[model samples]
Structure formats: C-alpha cells, structure tokens
Target: MIDGLDPEYLDACPAPNLAAMAQRGFRVNGNGMTPSVTNVNNVSLVTGSYPETHGITSNYLLDRQLGEEFYMESAEFLRAETMFQRATACGLRSLLVTAKDKLRRLLSDGATVSISSEDPPGWVVSGVGEPPPIYSLEVNRWVLDAGRYAMSQEPFDLVYLTTTDYAMHTYAPNDPESARHVTLLDEGLGAVLEQAPGARMLVTADHGMSDKTRMLHLPAELGRYGISARAIPVIKDRYVVHHSNLGGSIYVHLDESSDLNAALDTLRNLDGVEDAVSGEEAAARFHLMQERVGDIFVLADPSTVFGDPSEVAMPAGLRSHGSAHETTVPIFGCGPGLDTSTAARFRQNLDVGRYVFEDVLPPRPDGLLS
Candidate 1:
C-alpha cells in the first residue's frame, strides 16, 4: 500500500521489528497513489473502490455543481453504505476507531464503533441494543483497558484503532518517534493477539508518507482555469472536489459535470505535476476503484505535491501521509483462516481488512450493491 517500499527497502531492513512480521505473516508489493491521503485510501480499503465510487476523495469534500458544501468526512457517505454495516447485518460484531472520524462513521453504522478525532474518548458506552457507534474526543487510559477487554471478549468481532495514525501524522513515518508510537500501540495489539490467538489480525497503514518541502497549491491550479476550488484551505494537507447535487461518487460528479479532461490536462500539463491520470488509472494499477474514484488523478513527483502549505503549518519536523509526495507502506498479517497462498502478490490497503479469518466479507447487503 505504499510506493517506495520496493524490493530495495525490503533488502535494507536489517531490523527485527517488521522483518519478523513479514516472515511469520505475509508481505506484498504495491503502490499507493500520490496524494495518498488517508481518508480516501481508507475508504478505498473498506468499500473496495477508488474515491469516485466511494465518494470520499478527501477528508473535506466540496461540490459546486450541486451547491453542496459540507464535511463529506463521514464514513456514512461510503457509497451510502459501508462494509462494517454489512458485516453486522451478516452477524459479526465490529469495532472502529480512528483519527479519521469519517472512516469510523462510514464503516461502523450498524456495528459498534468507538471513535475519536483529536482524542480517544474514555467515557462512552452503549452495547445492548443497536446504538450509533460511540464517539469520544479524548484519548485516555480507559481506551487502552477497553481495547484489552474487547480483545478478550468472545462476542467482540471487529476492533480498529486510530491513535497510531495521529502519531504518525505528527511524527514522520521513518522517525524514531513514529516507531515509539507503534510500540505503544503494539502492546495493545499484542494483548489482543494473545487473547484471541485464534482470531485473524491484520496491521497496515492507511498510506505511506514522503517528506515534503513544498505543498502544491491545488486551488490555485484550479483557479487558473477559472474554477474556484473552495475546499483548498482545509487545515490538513488533503483536499476534495466534486459536483453538487449527486448521489454518485466524486469522479462521476466531477467528470460528468466539469471539463474534467481539460481540467486534468491543465493539471497534468502544469510544471509541478509529476504524474497525472484519471482516478480510473489509479484504480486499475493500485487496485483502487472497483466502483470508481475519479476519471483523472495526479500523483505528484517529488518535486510537486497537492496542498497549499502556506495555508497550514505542518508539525515541526513532521511530514508523513498528507503531502502530495510519494512514499511506501507495507501490510502485515498472520491470523486464523488466512489464505497462505501466494502471499507475495501485491494488494492495496483495503484488501487487508477484506477477509476476517480467511473469510471474505460477505457481499454488501445494502441495496446499493445493485
């Protein structure tokens, strides 16, 4: 699910932390698109589609064509349905939490969700009858304890954590700080592994990070074409664009309405555009859009990226997934029911979550499957 972690990176890994996991579990070679923003990539993992079909191209969504201006950050927006909800309808319990609150919402509708944005809240509980997935704002000791409890609880089916994502965002993925963060989270994961040794466990990053010195200005590029990109100034380094008034994915909204090819041509032709293609191209190569993402996409070369760095200040000496830069990430798993077949074939981020104990998530039940 990362770009640069090719065979070369693997050859250099003399450490025991990840190589041992690779030997025991499995490893794959794949490339996440440039602008490998988390929300879009995570949604792709769950829904098995590029942003066009999944409809979450970025954390912040804006569509001028239909007069739609709102936080398209909720997981509920996943093609108006999500895999987490689908899993519950089929009788599996699910737990989701992430700094990307939107993913939790989309994937945990019918299932139980414990989520937080800036913090993982400690005091939210509703387990009996169905309840809107739990959302908390602060990270505390309770979350750690509850995570342990969930790991041991037989009835618990799925559990997700976002604390690491926040830390990775604050600290570069290659940094020692990020490794320390992974260690802390690993303790909790190890607890789960020990308790549910029979259960399937898969670990992966939403996307990898490439250090960036310049954040490419997306709106300014769009503005040059006389299109005002409204969502440019979002605090994070991600951006979203689409047409207003549509139930379709972002690509449909953008392609059908705007001179997308022309817009893309403008984007591709730009001096900074390292690489450009439709989200379709990204989907095919990255295994991203089973549904759709966009007809066009741009994966900036190291020289150019996809945000207005001037608009927001990146953490001091921290740059990971949010830039338009390119980076590589790996997926790890060793659990029950996993297919040991050809583990070396590459896969995208979402493919990691697809099978629980070697069982492919049942086909989505919501009528949207049509």
Candidate 2:
C-alpha cells in the first residue's frame, strides 16, 4: 500500500506491495467521488451511497450558518446510516480506525475516542496554524501503542491503523516528505499485520492529493463580481473552466435570483468557464442534496481550481480538491481470500469495504479497537 495517501502521488507509487495486492485483488481505475474529500468519501464507502444519500459531503462541512466551524464529534454522525453500524447490527466484528476521528465515529459511532485521530479533521487551516485535525503522527504513535497494549490484554476481532492517511495529507504521496511519512505508516501497518497475520488486513484511503501551485481564491476574486457571498462551500469540485463572473454565496439555502438567465450569461462569458450548471445538476453530478449546497454552481476549468483553504501564507490558494481532476489514492489489500492481483478499475475508497470483508457489513474488533 502507498504510505502517502494522495492519488496524485500514486503515479509515483512503487507498485510492488500494491501491485501484488492488485494481482491478487481488484483495483480502481477512474477517479473517486467528487469533493473526493476524506469524510465524505469514507462515509460513501461504508454506506455504498453517494454523499447525498449519506448526507456528508466534506471533511470540513459548513453548518447552516455557513460558518467556518464544523462538528467534530461522533454524535453529529446522526446525518445518515453507516456500514460499520450495519456490521454491528449483523453481529459482525467491525473495526473503524483512521487518522480522522470523525471517520471512525461516523463509521462506528460511540465506539472509541481517539482524541488524536484524523477526524473532525487533519487540516491545515488558513488563519490558525495547521494543527493535527484528528489523526496524524500523533495517531500513529497512539494506535501503535494501543494496538500493542490490546494484543497483550486480549485478541481483537478487528483492528484499524489510522496514520497513513494523515501522513499523505501533509506530505502528499511520492514527495520525499511523503516518503518519510509513508515509511512511518508502513512501520505501523507492519506491526499490525504481524499481530493479526491471519485476520483480513485492509489498507485504503479516502481520497488522493495533487501537488499543485496555482491557487484560486473563490471568495476574494468572486467578491469583485456581483457573484459574491459571505461563504461558498463548493457543492462540486472547483471548476477548471468556470464562470468567473457569476460569483455566488453558499448557504443551506438557494436564493440566487434577479434574472437567472442574465446571471448565467455573464458567468458563461468569462474565461475558463464551462457552463453555469444549476444546483440540481451539481447535486446530480456529485450526489449531494439540494438543501445542503448553494443554488448556482460555477463550473471552472479542470486545470484551474476556484479556491483552496489550506494556504496560510497567502490569501487562500495552495491546494484544492473539488473538481473532476484526478488525485491518485491507494486501495491496497492483504487478506487470505483477497486476490492480490489486478487493480480494480475505478476503485473509489468508498468501495473498500467490499474488498476488505466478504460480508455486506464490515468486521469489528469486539471491544479491542474502541
């Protein structure tokens, strides 16, 4: 498996362990779901539904007020049904572990609390110095220590390691920085595998990352146009060919009126604009809900992103992930029944459940993981 998580970094993947895994199993070909963010993608994989059905479309989703803050607790997962819950209902041992704490709780609510996990976030915010959102190096240390402790105490039905994902978010795959992080993750996985050599060992990540230089400031740039909003949580990937003129504000409500056609026309006339797809179209494309996103969708060029919140030194534009652009993520496998050959075409991390476990629901750790 790739130590670093980002898909864009996958081309740089060594492909030995993963290729062996693919040789014995299936691998994904096309890019994963849009937004392709972690929390949204993991929920989709667990539920086998789109973000719309799962009701979570991002790692840092905006609440009704369009505030920058987002919920970071297992309780907020009341949004939709998850696969881990299904596993529990079926009496299967399901283990959900990740650098993201939100992912673990959403996957298996009220199970365990890894204050150091990569949930609620593992993000590098703009103003606040990027702290470890949920999982990261800290999680690796904690999980390794926890796993060893649990093994000594008793056997677990399932186990999860949640560091590789965090490593990728900061270092990205393929880069030297990523290599160091991936190596660290590999060490942890190696330990987990040694502990449970026979149990199904699944290695997968939510989405990939692309190393990019150009940054798009959606709020700052759009403000110049009548298309300004206090907020704009993109319902879709940042458009490469976009309507730079038709700026918009994102909220739980959609009320962009004042001659819709004119607004559409102005946006379409801008450079790098594909088409002013309505909220409905974006919902259909990204599998999001109408109530959760903005009304007007500004489709940008695939090559250029509209905005990214990761860059701190600048206004806002360093890395992005909201367009159809490809970001290579990892979906490696290690199990007895696993094929370990041939990568599955179009394997979204969301589809990882099927690969790891045979049953409809995932396996649990029987109090070992929590």
User: What is the lDDT of every predicted structure here?
Assistant: 0.48, 0.48
Tens-digit lDDT track for model 2 on 4-45?
A: 356455465453444554555545543456655555566666
User: How do all models score by TM-score?
Assistant: 0.69, 0.70
Instruction: Write model 1 residue lDDT over 1-370, tens digit each, in one string.
Output: 2212223333433334444456667766554433455566666665555555666655554444455645555645667345566667667777665443455554556666555433345433332112122221123223443555544544666666543233333444455654454454445456656777777666665555444444556556667786543322212322121101111012322424467667767766777566556656766654453333345545555533345445444333434443334335566677554334635433755565444422646654554451
Q: State residue 106's C-alpha deviation in candidate 1, in Å.
A: 3.4
Give the range of the ten consecutive residues with the poorest summed lDDT in model 2: 240-249
TM-score of 1: 0.69
- Residues forming the 10-long window of minimal summed lDDT in candidate 1: 240-249
Give the number of colliding residue pairs in candidate 1: 17
Model 1 scores a C-alpha lDDT of 0.48
Q: After superposition, how far is residue 148 of candidate 1 from its true place, in Å?
A: 2.4
